[model samples]
Structures are given as structure tokens and as C-alpha cells.
Target chain A: MQREHEPNEHAHHGPDKPTYNLVFVALTVLMLLSVGTAYIELPDILHYGILLTLMSVKVGLVVAYYMHLKYDNPLFTWVFILPVLMGLAVVLSLQGLAGY
Target chain B: MNAAHTSVHGAEHGHGHSISNEQHNHMLKFGWWLYIASEVMIFSSLIAVFMLAKRLYPAEEEHLVLPLVAFNTFLLLTSSWMVVRGLVSIQRGDQVGLQRALMITVILGSIFLGIQIYEYNEFTHHGVTLTSSMYGSAFYIMTGFHGFHVFIGVLWALWAFFKALNGHYTAENNIGIELFGLYWHFVDVVWVVLFTLIYVM
Candidate 1:
């Protein structure tokens, strides 16, 4: 069997072609869902909640597959996600303090 | 070890036999991740400011045009997919496919920027300048910085396209394209958050 050339010690085997197409389609569907959600009339809390939930799912897909974080080293994932968590905390705290 | 000694060792060990390229690429990715982590903080601060401003002054909500921004969001999402396709093509040793995908990605990025410019013009015409109000200032600062990021990503994609045309990449060695994809996708993810927090919510 022929071994694939490893770009780095931490890099996994690259994703297959079909996986990219699948992710592309998934992202498109999520985009449409989020846009559709925006047009629906719901209570303020529920409306924002659904929008944010959909946004989070989209972000997860992009970061995991498109960015190859799922295939790369866990260290890199920590490097990327920690800051995002911190940002979320800070944003939420500020929003609370601002009386929103 | 000294530079001369290291070079001699590298030459003796040869390319694939040595771990130099692998280690170098790992370090490169690590550094890029660190840079992006810092960017996360910067954008977080901008988002915080925007939220606070909005809370303090509710009138800013009336100024946003959701439908136009939603269309812009779709363009960025499509461009992100194109960049991923470019990466996938190069991974499969399809240089022509990579080049075409990258060219399309750059065009899409440019169109997104053009729409943003038009949006800003509309805002300013409606007295939504930086000095207009706290809301206006926050709005421009957050989205403008994001626009600047998209512009930079487009330039990066253009460079990648030129490199692909010059046959600088191959199936086994295309770290440049991968790194560019990471950056472009990061910009896209940022926009997803911004669009949700600012436009939709």
C-alpha cells in the first residue's frame, strides 16, 4: 500500500472530496435556515435564541471541517476555541451590564 | 546547533527522510492560530462595544437594512465554499480546478466588498457617519473592520490564484493554499457571528 505524504506530524489524512461537497451543501442549507428564521415572527427572546443557535451551528461546521480543525492537532483546536469562549463570556457580561 | 551544522545535517538527512518540513509546517500553523486567537479578542471587544452602544441607544436598530445584509451574508458564504473547493481541488492534484475555484473565490470576495461599500454609502447619506451617534460609530467600527478583513482575504486569494497558475502547488505540497483557506474561512466565521449579533438579533 502506498503511504500518503504527511505534511506535518500533527496533520491527519486530508479529507475526501465528497466530504467537502457534503459540508458545502450543509453550510448552504444552514444559511437558508437562518435567513428564513429571520423572517418569522416570534417572541423577542425565542427569535434571537433561534438565530443565535443556528449561527453557532454554522460556525461549528466551518471551523471544524473547512478549517480542518477536526483533522488537525487538538492543540490547534484549543488555540482557536479558547479565545472564542472568552469572547463570548466578555460579550455576554458587557451586554448584561449595559442592561440589555 | 549552528546554522552551518544544521544545513549539513539537513542535506545529509534529505527532504522526506528529515522531519524539517513537517515540523516547520506545524510551527507555521501554530503561529497562525495564535494570530487568529488575538484577532478573536479584537473582534470581541468590537462586538461588546456595539452591543453596549445599541443598548444605550435603541434608535440604531431602525437604521439597519436586514434584507441587504442578508444578501451580503449569502455572498460571503458562497465565497467560503469556493475557497474550500479550491483547497480540495489542489489536494486531488487538480491545478486547473484549483485555479478556477480561486479565481471565482476572489471575484465573489470583491463583489461582497462592493456591496459593503454601497451599504456604507447609503448609511453615510442618511447621516450615519462616525460622528452621528454612539450607535453609528459602533456599527461602522465593527462592520468596517470586518470589511477590511474580507478585503485582505481577497488579496490573499488573488495571490494564491497566481501561485496556482505558476504551478507552485501540488497534491503533496500546498501549505500555502491551506493556510490561505484557513484565513479566508476565519473571516467568514467572523461574519457569521457579526451578521447574527448585529443584523438579525
Candidate 2:
């Protein structure tokens, strides 16, 4: 298999054209959904759970599409994702300590 | 255009070949990752402190001032949209459009900072100070730090806007723009977390 070029990284071609506009629209819709969800009077656990889930989805979409993590290689994944995982670990620990 | 150097550190080398180039980018990438890690630690600490303060001052929870922050959130969200639109403009090689979008982003950012300052004055008038109470301390520190980031982002966007006017970036060589996009998106992400934690919660 031919190696991916690095100099003009953005000018890359794939089996199908990247649908950035579509991805952006979807992101906007997700944001709106989160906002609407925030206004709902759900139980506290379910409320926070839904918000966190939506946020996780939003972050995934932004990373994969806006940041092009989806198109990149595994090396790129490790480079960026390790810190995020560590951050999540820290957040979880903090939440645990806070008794939340 | 410069010749594509065959060195391991040039720009095209990837894994399994020249360990030098691979290692070089990896070092920068690792450093950036560490920077983000350190940032996570710092913010987490601040958030921990905020939580402690909130627990100690549950009475202030009823007095939680959120409308201004909600408006501030709108400003930030609008600015994020503008910055993303500017990136799309750059990708399309629309210099005029890029300049316009970046200008809107900068203006919105400035407006955000302005409202934040105004809110600070309002807080002071209402006897809220850095040492006033736990609520005041946490509220100011967390929101103040975020406002500072917005200020820096505004400056960064302004610089990029001027560069675009000077024909500095092309669709083919717009890594600077993308880097700015990363910073902008990061700021937006931070605000998203803050809005949920500090305001909505």
C-alpha cells in the first residue's frame, strides 16, 4: 500500500469525499439537542447521565471530524487520545472523591 | 517549493522508516499531550476547589447568578461558530470571507470579555470579591481564568485575520489556521464543561 503523504496533508483523497459540512450540521444539531435536554426535568441521575452521554458523543464527533482524527492513523490516535483518557481518569477520581 | 528532503525528519517520513523523523514529531506530539495533561490537572484542581466552596456555601446556591453567564455562554458559542466558519472560508481560499468571519469572531470575543468585565463590576458592587466568600472566590477564579483564555483566543484570531489579509495562508498551507482552530475549539470545549458544571449544575 502507498504511504500517506504528509506535506499537503489536507489535500488527501479517499474512497469518498469528506463531508465536513454534513458533519458540522450534525454537530450543531447535537448541541441543540444537549441544550434541549438540559431543560427537561428528569431525575438527577438520569439528567446528568444524559448530559454526559450527549457530551461524550459531541466530543467524539468533533474529534473525529473537525480534528480529522478519524482519517488519521493509529499513531495519531495514541498521540492525542492518551491525554484525554488520562484527563477522564482524573475527572472520575475527582467525582468519586466528591461523593458524586 | 523546497525539495522533499529524504531525511527522516523532513515531512513525509512516517513510522517504520527513519526513526529520527518519527521520533521528532513524536516528541512534539508528546510534549503537546503533556501540556494538555498538565492543563487537565490544573483545571481539575480548580474545579475541586470550586466544588468544596459550593458545598460549604450551599446558601449561595439559591443566590446563584446565572443570567449573565448564560449570555456569556451565548457569546462564546457564537464566537466558536464564527471561528469554524472562518476555517471553512480559509479552506475554500476565500480570503475576504475568512477576514470577515475572523473579524466577527474577534468582535464577539471582545464583546464577551466586555460583558465579563461588566459582570465583575456588578459583582464588586454587590460585595462580591476575591475574598468575599467561597462562592465569590470560586466564581471569580474559574470564570476569570476562562475569560483570560477568551482574551488570548481573540488575540490569536486577530493575528490570523491580519495574516489572511496579507495572503499568508493558502488552502494548501493552512496549518496555522488549523492550529488556531484547535485552540478555539479547546476554548469552546472548556466553556461547555464550565456551563454545565458552574451554571447549570
Name the best candidate (by lDDT). Answer: 1
C-alpha DockQ of every model: 0.50, 0.24
Query: Interface Cα RMSD for candidate 1?
Result: 3.3
Residue B135 in candidate 1, Cα distance off native in Å: 1.0
TM-score for chain B considered on its own, for each of the candidates: 0.90, 0.81
Q: List, residue by residue over B28-106, the lDDT tens digit for candidate 2.
A: 5445545555665566667767766776776655544566666676676666666666666666676887789789889
Q: How many residue pairs clash in each candidate?
A: 0, 0
Which candidate achieves the best TM-score against the true structure? 1
Per-residue error for A91 in candidate 1, Å, reads 0.9
lDDT of 1 by residue, A1-100 (tens): 2334534423335565567677778877877787787678889888878888889999998998888888778999999989999998999998887773
> Candidate 1: misplaced stretches above 4 Å?
A1-12, B1-18
Worst 10 residues of 1 chain B by lDDT: B1-10
